[model samples]
Target: MLASVHSEILREKLLLPGETLVVGVSGGNDSSALLHILVALNKNYHYGWKLHAVHLNHCFRGEEARQDAAYAQELCGKLGVTFHLFEFDVPAYMEQTGMGGQEASREIRYGFYRQVAKEQGATKLVLAHHADDQVETILFRFVRGTRMQGLSGMPKRRWLEEGSIELVRPLLHVTRKELESYCEENGLHPREDSSNRSRKYKRNLLRLEVMPLLAEVNERYREHILEAAEAIHQDHAFLERLAIEQLEKVLIVRKPDEIVIDNEPFQNCDVALQRRMITLILDYVSKQTEWSSQHVEAVLHMSGGSRPSAELHLPGQLVVSRVYGRIHFCPKGREERIHMYCYELPVPGKVWIAESEVWVHTNYLERLTDWERLPENEAVFDADRLPGPLFLRNRRPGDRLALFGSGSEKKLKELLIDTKIPRAWRDRLPLLIAGDEVVLVPGVRRSAAAPVDERTKRFLHVRVEFGEDWREVFS
Candidate 1:
């Protein structure tokens, strides 16, 4: 059994030499047995690595929790691996945070493990989710109306945060029966977690009850479950790629808060692709709660104009609002506001704004006589002629601007009104300021103070374009 798991690990390239391995030791049979097998493998195979055991204590079962922590500590001591433990009152956390019992416990436990892994400089954190656990997860998500990704179950390895290491499930292909058999064969004493016996959990019921019925029908029931999961996992990967492509093509995104979508794409796409697109939108829009099929269907129904300017308040502060025949997804309380920043125009560099990119080049400076030729959101300035240092910034109340050829002080809002720009659009418009004076409002007006002339030594030529969406292209 160890040899087969070792072969799978090697085949998957799950572990690399010379990196710290942080094993999540729950003091349960699965985790404890996994630790023993990995330690034995490390010693026998001369795998160059450092090992540390992490135990997250939810403090739910009192002495039972302490016993689990103690057992993990003992195992770490016997194996000469460093051990770390953290405890939290999960019940209080659930009440305060409004997260459910299992959900809160999982979030807390994984959060602790990630912090520990970072502190220990671990390259990969190991989990003991065996084949049966994956099957249960797939079934659970299916019952919960999950799309393709959830039905695929847990990934074998995924980066929790890129370059911060990953959570790896090396025992994914290993079964509980196989692990128990291996433990008995090697005379390894493993502690059973008492919580597993509680049939209150859906997974517990499946393991103790539903699985027996399936096994009686076919002795190779576990193998069938594993095979089905593998096939679903492949399908999930394909659909994920498709979803990403659709997101890139049709997603109307605004950074950190808003995403606007046109109804045309969904109305045009096949239902399968439409479901995939919905999953991508929910996942990318915000780190919201697990989206249900009903939520997607509701959004789709809204896209079909089920209501008059309807709004759906989703989990994680996401607000889906329908306005002007487009569905907009934004962080709650953010729709009525615009966050604008005055940024420096670095010569020969790029300026990023919501759904737009501005490239400033010296050669492009000659093309503009008046800023009116610029997009309603762009402007150009003579770099060398600006009063000492130029600054990019926001509009403040009582702010005055000198309209070119008209020396009278004009309010920024009044100028925006004259230009026929909406109040919201005006809020995000970049205002070029030079020494407390509005030098230029790109794509709008330029100050009489700094007019482009042949005497201008260095020119700031800016090219700005807007689109429905933007991405972190450099990164």
Candidate 2:
């Protein structure tokens, strides 16, 4: 059995040369067996992959948890492989973070694995989640009324954090019973975590109680469950591709944070495609695990908002805003009062806005037609007439600026209040100032003293671009 399973894995994918593989060995039967097989493969075949074992002592089981780490260390020593152990205060962390036991444990364990994998110079972090685990995940998501992505169960590989390390589940096709049988046949010793039998966790109850009853009715229940998960995974991939194509047509993915959805095009899509369209938008905004069906339904119904202006908040801090017959999916924490700064022009060049990446630049001269063509919001000043070392700073309370052409000064606060600039943006907007006087407010207004005149030696060319992805930035 052990040889057959080993042969099956070898038939799948050969490890690339000089590949560094990190295996999570929790001393449990599944993980320990996985480590033993990988170690064997490392030696039996001249596979140039170096093996490193990682164990996270959750500290929930006290000394027994330490014993589990010790067992993993002993196993690694016997196999002559490098071992890493991480101890975490799971209970205290759970209380502090208000996360359930399983959630906390998962977060800590995976976090430790990713960190250790990076430190050990590993490219891939492998886990021993088998077919039975996938089936249980499917059942759990099904009970929660999840979409197809949830029913698809676990994936083979995914990048958790870009450029760090990839998550790989190597034995996903193998069954738990098959792993244990391989360990028994190969004389491989494995530790059994006592928590596995405890019904305190929801997963444990489903595994120990529900799965056994189903298996009693059918001998090949595990195979059937795995087949269902595989089918769902295939279907989910197809839907995801279709959604991505549809999003390219109906969505303006402005940036990683900003996206604009065309409600007119979305409403024209079929009802089945409507759900997928909403899901693609939510995923692009949040990258969350699962969104409820009810929320997707609500977004679909919101295609035609009876209210002229309406906004809705969904899971993962996603905000859907509707305006002028267009629906937009905006990120949360973006709805604060605008902050404006009074900045002094600095050397007639680009200036950076600290609150936002937006940059402002000034050029020497432009055609009269160019000045007129510039948007009223953009500040085009007479560069030569302006003093050097112009400063850019945020707007302050009681700040006053001379109105252009009117030659009358008004308090910045009073103007902002009349314009209905939200109170939060008072301190965030970039204010251009030359010494004691305000020069220009990019995307807002220009100071009177800095207005274009014949005496102006240089015609300023001003434009704004974000710190990142200049091409995708809005004017």
Candidate 3:
């Protein structure tokens, strides 16, 4: 049993030599067997791991919870491992957070694990989520309207914190029956949670009732489920890579609060890639937005509609808008202009200024237009001379502008004052940003940064319109 368990721990460098680890010991069959196996490996294999056993008393089972924590500490002591125990009121936490009892308990338990690992300077938080847990999770999620991601089940190893801390399940391939046998042979009398016996819990019902029924139907149901889940996980990972590659092809520009993509390139992608890209975009521009398949379908329908312009508001203040062939996304209240914001202005494309209710679009001109008769809402520049990857943003402090045909630069504040632009509207006005220079301040001033000259081969024509008419942006 020890040899079999050792093979799985070394499956993917789950446990390293001379490293600190925090083991979650619930004094249950699975966790107790996990601790025993790890301790045996550490001693026999000369893997100098500094083990710290952590037990969290969730206060759900009252006296039983106390015994669970005590047993965990005793077991750790017998193995010569440092023990740490923490308590949290799972019932009270559920009340304050409005979470279900089981969900709240797991949340508190995992949080306690993270805290202990951090305190102990551990790199990995080890848990005993065995193969049975994976089979049950996959089966549970399948019955609970979960999609592709859910059917894959829990990962053997995943980062608890992106780079700093990882959570590993060394016994992910181990079965509950195998663990129980291991515990008995090792003389570690692990406790069983009384609550697990209650059929009121959906998981317990599935385990006690549904699982047995499935096993009677086919004794190898657990093995079959595990195989299917592993295949789905691999397929999901492949799809993710394909989606990321497709996303880069269509994405025109991205900012801290906004993302702009070309519909032409986006529509060319496979439906699978398209759906994934939308989900990824929504994920990037959200603050814990709980989006679902319904939201993704709505965005698809909105973008594919007959109208040239449309908009939808999703959870987390995310605003999705379609302007002809361009799709835009930013948070709500971004149009208020109180925050410092920047927008990308793609060459031969358009930018909608939500703050000023203005649309600024660009096009490449074959010849220079008459500047004397040009409207204040339009400007022309040498596309060959201007820098690539243009942007439209508000004025910044200490910004200097080099006027057309002028050798010197002028302070933006002084320029705004000279133009009689109101103080309140100074920060609200959109300025065309090219690389590091302020190229154009809409309806106010134009800079000499990319002036069209006699040697100019391509002309960049920029036109601005005032209003929320996205159709005008497309035109």
Candidate 4:
């Protein structure tokens, strides 16, 4: 195991002789093996490397966590290496940040590691993520709806926090089983946390339940996944270079919290580059570690939209908007407060759309009214066909509507643009929804789900009356 890790480090050019390094030790098999391996290599080869073992006790497991920290310190003492232990309240962090347990733990844990590295003036922070861990990560991201970049899994080494510190993983070629066996052979007596077996966490579930099932189907699952990941990494690396070049070319403004790009030049680039460039912007300004592909597509739609200006409100207070000929990304309180609203419409009653200043009136009738004369402002539907009570809300991303004649669903944003709706008013446009379906867009169009036909016994007469001219608001 030591020989393989050394070979991996040398081939990847992971370390230089006598460089200061920080190794994270969790008192588990994986991290313990990593720390011991580095120590062995340092002494045997006369590398003269300065190694610091850092352990963080996330205040969750009570006595078990404290014991883990103590064990890490004892091991470091036995190896005659410097050790540092820190305790942090992960639950409080999650509560304050509204992040999940796993996400908060990782965020604070890496942050603590980086701080220690900076204090020690070390450039490399080593970890023990192995081949099996890599496979799990790839599978997790695949299930969570990611792009090609995520499918590549973790890199052997990457820069953390804008290239200030290097994060190195020398065990990518090793397996967890091998690490455990090495610990047994060396009498390391690594400590184990009870939380790893908890089924409440999705990752633990995957490892404890899903992984063995996959192994049952194919014993070489880990090798196959890692091989595919390596291939994807190569392809993504090529596209990443292109994306960086494209971003530099189209960049009009760049800042820590804001980015602006020339819209025309961005559009001229290949569709693939465009997507990657936007991802680069997101990495810079967005606070979240991961973003869904739908978020990227929404931004793309906004760029090609007919509206002269528009804004897409993303989670974590990040705002992506188009202004004239430039696209801008702003994080941290760009807008004071978003005015998007939703309201329930009562059947056989009336409700008012506050933003659009229109009244929605619904009535049940034995015979259908002459709604064809004003299809834009009124719709007659088969009462029995509505999925549920009508709901009035503003637009959401991926909202689709089925037109009267069109067999397929049309993206609501594109439909609004086709009708020449102002971007400013689009978000405030009243949409009557029935269950998951958008049944009516007053002064725009109606859904095809609840059609009025001669066979219809009961009727749904829905009408909207604008305080001002409805045409003025929509335009």
Candidate 5:
């Protein structure tokens, strides 16, 4: 097994002469085999690769985790390799991020690995993902309605942290049984993680229960799955290149917080390319490559819609909007607040607020309607007394508003709380601003300073709507 892995690494040119490499050792059979084999290759073949071992104690399983770290440290010590160890509160991370145990552990583990690689100045980080793991990953994604990208499973080599470090999995071609045999044959007693046998986790359940039953049907299931993944990965890579090319042609604007594309060209492309383009944009914007099929389908449907202006809210506070002839993808709150910008409202026209996903319309009225019967979302102002070029924006600090019929002015924050608005929505709520004063808060209040009177000659009618149905708010 070691000879096979060493030959594969050489053929793949995974390691360079005298280059520093960080090996992630979890004290499990796979990592233990990886560390031992690499150490042996260095001694015999003069591989000349500087090896450093890193172990993350995922503050779970209490004493058992500590023991695993200690064992990894001891093994690295015996091999004359520098050992690095760190501890992280993974349970706390899971709770904070609302991620499951497996996801949280993997995220924390790789983050620590990246830090160690940077500190050690190692260009490559080694992982111990094997053939069985690949099979499990493909099967898991298959059961979850994956596309070709997900079907590709894990790549053997990829760049981490924006090419700052390389992650290599040399064990992808090797099986778990072979790794266990290699460890036993070399007298390397790897520490066993008891949690692997637990069925609470999806991966564990698949490994312990589902995979064995599948193996009964065909013992070569792992190899077949690996082959399928390889084929899918090749096709995915080619499509990704084409998608990127298509994106370059249609993408009109690309910024850190937002991306805009010409909808006509994108809509005319092949559906496959469209999906890839959407995924690429999403991954670039979110800084992750884990979008679902449903998300892509939703964007596709929105892109194909005939509405002059439409918006779809996605997970992670992302909003995809189609306006005029362009499609805009932006985070709901590009920063802490929904982009503190004042957009000039067009008179007798409609303006779409990307941050709030609300449409604001202004109309010139010859006569005022009954004030008591008007919807709360609609506000009438005396056009002759109002300032020019009214704008819509979020509330700024120290912003005060005088409600109609109220004697005193109050801060916007105080008004929001009194209205029982959610604290999270306070900063993102839309406010109609004229010059420096907040005139109206949609579905909330109309300022006393801008009320229409009996003597008014012209009236400015403003209304706000949200979502596909343009649900009207009556305050």
Candidate 6:
């Protein structure tokens, strides 16, 4: 078993020389076997790996949990390896996040693992997830409705924190039965969790009831499921690469708060690529793996058709909007129509707009230097020719502006439409209002009322700084 496991690890290239490795141990058969195998491989084969064992107590099983942590510590001590133990309040976490017992436990457990790996300076974090886990995951995702990405199951090796920490599952090719047999052969007494026998959890019910029933129908159901997952993983990887290429072409703007895509280019892609691109965009913005096939379908539905405008509220507080020839995907409150308010702009002062989360800084300059070379987000206006105290706010009804270089005055709404601004974003766009007149619309058109050519003695330099992407509000 050790020789085969070592060969599998080598084939997978899970470890490199002179690197620190953190192994997650739960005092269960699978993890015990993993720890023992890794230690043996390092000692006999000189794998040159600095190994550290980490155990997280979920604080659910009371005495049994403490016993498991103790056993893990003693086992590591006997093997002359370092041990780290941490405890978490899984129930409290579940209550706080409104998650179930299983999800909260898993989230806290992995968070603890990552924290330990970082503290230990480990480059790779190892888990004992075997082929059985992969099969279970695939079945679980399928039963709950998933896309190809979720059906692909767990990966063998992946970056947990891009470029910082990696996660490796060396036992992915090994079965639970094999690991149990190896533990017995090595005389490793592993603790069994009683919760695994409880049928309250869906996974337990699937493993105890559904899996056996399926096995009765087909003796090799588990093996077949694992094979299917592997195939889907390969196909998903290929499609994901193609989707990324297509995304770069159609993606108009990508920011932490939102992502904009050209409707024509996105609509022209194959259905598979379109679905993948939508999923990629959601995943990138949310930074969470909770998006489902339903969310993807909702986005696709909203972006489809020749409808002038449509909007759909999705999971994770995300809102997908399709306006004219553009698709906007952003957080719920970030979606264009933010609350409108007017605040006095103080000269030589900075004001942070809570509604838009933007900072408007105004400075008085004696004279303008290279006025035509100002940045896109900055504008200089004649201070002496101003109508009254300047006020900054969103576009209001009946707002009109005499666009620069255009003699005729146009309504703010008409100007925005002519400028090709998404209809949904017109209300959220910031404007510098002087008394009843519009002076400057940052990153867009500037009012012809405050043109500064040469007679200006004092100039007001106003700059808009957005905490997130300025393009979301301006472009």
The CA lDDT of each predicted structure is 0.72, 0.73, 0.81, 0.84, 0.83, 0.85
TM-score per prediction, in order, is 0.70, 0.76, 0.64, 0.69, 0.70, 0.81
Q: Supply every candidate's count of residue pairs whose N, Cα or C atoms clash at under 3 angstroms.
A: 5, 27, 0, 0, 0, 0
Model 4 clashing residue pairs (backbone): none
Evaluated at residue 433, the lDDT of candidate 3 is 78
Assess candidate 3 and give its lDDT: 0.81
178-240 in candidate 3: lDDT tens per residue? 999888898989989999999999999999999989999999999999999989999988998
Ten contiguous residues with the weakest lDDT in model 2: 466-475
lDDT of 2: 0.73
- Greater-lDDT candidate between 3 and 4: 4
lDDT by residue for model 5 (56-86), tens? 9888899999999999999999999999899
lDDT of 1 at 176: 79
Name the weakest run of 10 consecutive residues (lDDT summed) in model 6.
Answer: 466-475
- For 1-475, candidate 2 gives per-residue lDDT tens digits of 4466455556645245578988889998899888888887778776778888889988888888888899899999998889988888999998996776776787788787778777778888888888888889888777767777777788877765556677777787788888888888877777778898899878899988888898789978878877887798898788778877877887654566667666678778777677877777776666533576777877877777676556788755678776545576767777564555444445456666767556777666555545645664466677656655567777765678888878798888877655544343456666676766766655556768756766666667666554542222122
In terms of TM-score, the best-performing candidate is 6
User: Candidate 3 — which residues are off by over 4 angstroms?
Assistant: 250-267, 278-475
- Where does model 6 exceed 4 Å of error? 255-258, 287-290, 305-385, 389-430, 444-468, 472-475
TM-score order of candidates, top first: 6, 2, 1, 5, 4, 3
Which stretches of model 5 miss by more than 4 angstroms?
A: 255-258, 308-325, 329-332, 335-475
Lowest lDDT 10-residue stretch of candidate 1: 466-475
lDDT of 6 by residue, 324-352 (tens): 68888888776546777888999999998
Clashing pairs in 3: none
1 or 5: which has the higher lDDT? 5
